[model samples]
Target chain A: MARWEPDAQARLQNAALELVARQGFERTTAAEIAEAVGLNRRTFFRHFPDKRDVFFAGQDQIEADLVAGVTGAPPGESPMGLVGLALARAADTFAHLPREQARARQAIIDAEPALLERERQKFAVLARSVGDAMRERGVADLEATLAAESGVLVFKTAFTQWLADGESRSLPLIIAETMAALRALYVTR
Target chain B: MARWEPDAQARLQNAALELVARQGFERTTAAEIAEAVGLNRRTFFRHFPDKRDVFFAGQDQIEADLVAGVTGAPPGESPMGLVGLALARAADTFAHLPREQARARQAIIDAEPALLERERQKFAVLARSVGDAMRERGVADLEATLAAESGVLVFKTAFTQWLADGESRSLPLIIAETMAALRALYVTR
Candidate 1:
């Protein structure tokens, strides 16, 4: 792999997002994305299996980090606590992206039904991964699944609020607050 | 539509499931589904736009029923209570299907990535609808969203446990118990 492979992949993704935003996802081509990044189609294909995958390129790494986070957490913590920490760490992975790029990508996903389906599947996969990681910690089946799924809900709700127009909270802060709020819901009754 | 329209649609769906289970989803054609049901191709198209829709045809009605349940609940009910009741009512919509048919359809979906993606999207949509219905009842946004999402987790968890081998608990009982369990998770901490 080239020393600059990561940068090249990011560039290809950014270019693809720009092209997909200008023209609909259906009209965008892999060659065009590569050309915009000053790379060849073969180079693009090396980084991404297809144009659709370019947007979801970091999913594998993110999923691994989430699972590792849960599995590596101190064993004394509760299941939901472990899941929460794992998802918070995963949120940290996205701190590197510029807001404009994030918004641009989200726009394309919001506009395309196919991309929305892919996004939902990504979240589902993350929930399953977190559940399995919980089981690896000796948690029971139902508890692990429920805690993992609830953690995912917190992650999604926080991400939505963090990205909303004019909202300025950091992802971790938002996630923590959302988790507290979710817990508080049951307490008030 | 004719008096037999509902019966025809149900037959087509049953036939589609049988064929999809036998030869796989990609290999099963619309004509074959119609032939299995002893119906014409035109009748198939009238009910479902494509082969994929045959499996998802009930989603529209189910979603509508869920939303209505939330909206029409007693004003004094908690958001989670309303959501739980709504989901239970929706389960009744599927109570008429034979257990074997439900198992066969679920097995196909579990084995196919595409069908799994569709299922996740369906769950997401239901969560959104329940949340919106909560909003309509004067509930705050974040609370409504969280409650709806948590309710979906309960619904899913109950459905999984209910459908497991040798399990025969009624859907309402299972849903009620799952919601209690979820709330209990927050209490003991």
Candidate 2:
């Protein structure tokens, strides 16, 4: 076997999600997932630190994109506007994922307490990163934190809508609409 | 020993916080906490499901109070207004706790990953409860969720300020100010 296989990470992730969704996260093992994809457990460990991490493969890239979005936002954008750009960047990532795969991954996460906790921690870290990025743009400390959290809240809302059964809207459209709704909450009578 | 002792829960909570703060969350056992307060481990379990539960003793009451605040809010109140009332109700609960104990409990939670996960879970549940309460008040589902999450965000920001060194504002006051700040983000230029 070649030392490096093409798209090993994606293959492993698909296998892991399929197996875990079918047999349940607790019942599935890392070795079993790797074997399903014709890779050894050592290779699996090389891609992900643990079984839980397989479910969150693109987390680092998502965080980096969010930070870059904030850092490279157009000048004179409000804190909330910077968050909007960051969320759009995240939407781009989610848009590339097949809806069925994303739905299956969400189901696995929703059913497992450990996975849910990891998701929460990931969101917390992402919010902190976004907040720090806002600070670099000269947004006040408290405002940065507020904007970051609100952005995550909007992302969560928009993502849920996108994942809803029979919901046909694009992720970016849902994000823009959700952001508008959030702003409307304060602006309208 | 009497089957029921007055203030047993409060005493156990105090002991648990002191022990957990001094020795750390993982090292402090339910048995040690009970013994410190002159109670048995069984009695401790009666009040709390586990050691982790000690740090979240009033969670149920806080949930109930928030729901009650939302349900009993004035007619014609906006969803966000109801969230404000619920947050104020929660602030009232925090105001009664000794600041020193609150600070110590926070320190313990901050240092422990398990506790932080539990804290995140608690907040998630609290947000759900608040959202349901809004539903009962005829708020739309999406708006209810957004308001509930945004309210929790304000509580978190205000709570952090309340716990900051040398800061002395009451929780309710801080909560109000944080809410204002959140509104300002969407309203101001």
Candidate 3:
């Protein structure tokens, strides 16, 4: 086997998801996933600590993007404005992923309570990180937490809509629309 | 021992928390917890399915209270208004719990990742139930979800405040103040 495999991480993630979706998460093995991608089990273990980690492959990158979005916002923007920019940026990460692949991933997560728990934990961490970023930019503590959580709520709502059957809008567009709807809720009456 | 012991559930819960806080959640056993409160392992199992459940003893009642608060709102209340009422009612449940006990429970939850994951899952369930109750009250689908999520965020924020060392406000007051802060985020400028 070649010592250097290009895009090995991506290949392993794709293979893991495909195998898990077909055979179920518990039934799938790391070795089988590696073999399907023409890599050894060692290579799979090197890329991911466990099979479940493969299911959440790009979460760190997504979190970094969100934090950068908040930190880089123009001075004088409201806390919610910073959150809006951050979530829109994070939505772009989803834009690069194939909707069918994302849907399949969601299906696997939905079927497994353990995976769903991990997903919830991931969002909790994301909210905390985004809130910290907002605080670094001088937003008040309570406001930062509220904005970060609200941003996550918008992302979740828009992600669901983006994955809906026959929906044609881009993820970023859906995120923007969701943010607008959230604002509308508070402003009306 | 008598098969029916009065307040066995609450006794077991208090004993479990004390044991777990002293010995750590991983080191504590259901039998040990039951023994601390003058009960047997069999009696503990009857009250809770697992030892971890003791920390979350009254969650079902809390969920029911939140849902009822949403469903029982006066006619023509807005979605956010309904959420505000629901969370404030949920706050009352926390008010009945002694501050030190709630603080200890939170410490244990914060120390254990498994417990924290379960807590997040509980909140997720609470949010969904709150949203469903809003839907039954004629709120639109997206608005209902958004409002429910926002309510949970307010609850979490107020909860942390209520637990803070120097803060003495009631949970319901903190929840209402948090809801007002959430609204202020959108209404200002």
- Positional deviation of residue B181's Cα in model 3 after best superposition, in angstroms: 1.0
Give per-residue CA lDDT, model 3, range B5-83, as digits (tens): 9899999988988899899999999999999978899989988887778888778888898898988889999998888
Strongest candidate by lDDT: 2
Quantify all predictions' global Cα lDDT against the true fold: 0.82, 0.88, 0.87
DockQ of candidate model 1:
0.64
lDDT of 2 by residue, A101-136 (tens): 788889899999999999999989989999999998
How well does chain B match by TM-score in each candidate? 0.89, 0.95, 0.94
Give me the runs in candidate 3 sitting further than 4 Å from their true place. none
lDDT of 1 by residue, B1-189 (tens): 354765888889889898998999889889889887678888789988766778887788778878878987888787767777788777787666466667788888888887888778888898899899899888889989999898778877887887788878776677777777777777666
TM-score of 1: 0.93
For residues A53-131, write the lDDT of model 1, one tens digit per residue.
8989778877887887898898677887787778777878866657667777888988999888888888888889999
Better of 1 and 2 by DockQ: 2
Task: Look at candidate 2 and give me any clashing residue pairs.
Answer: none
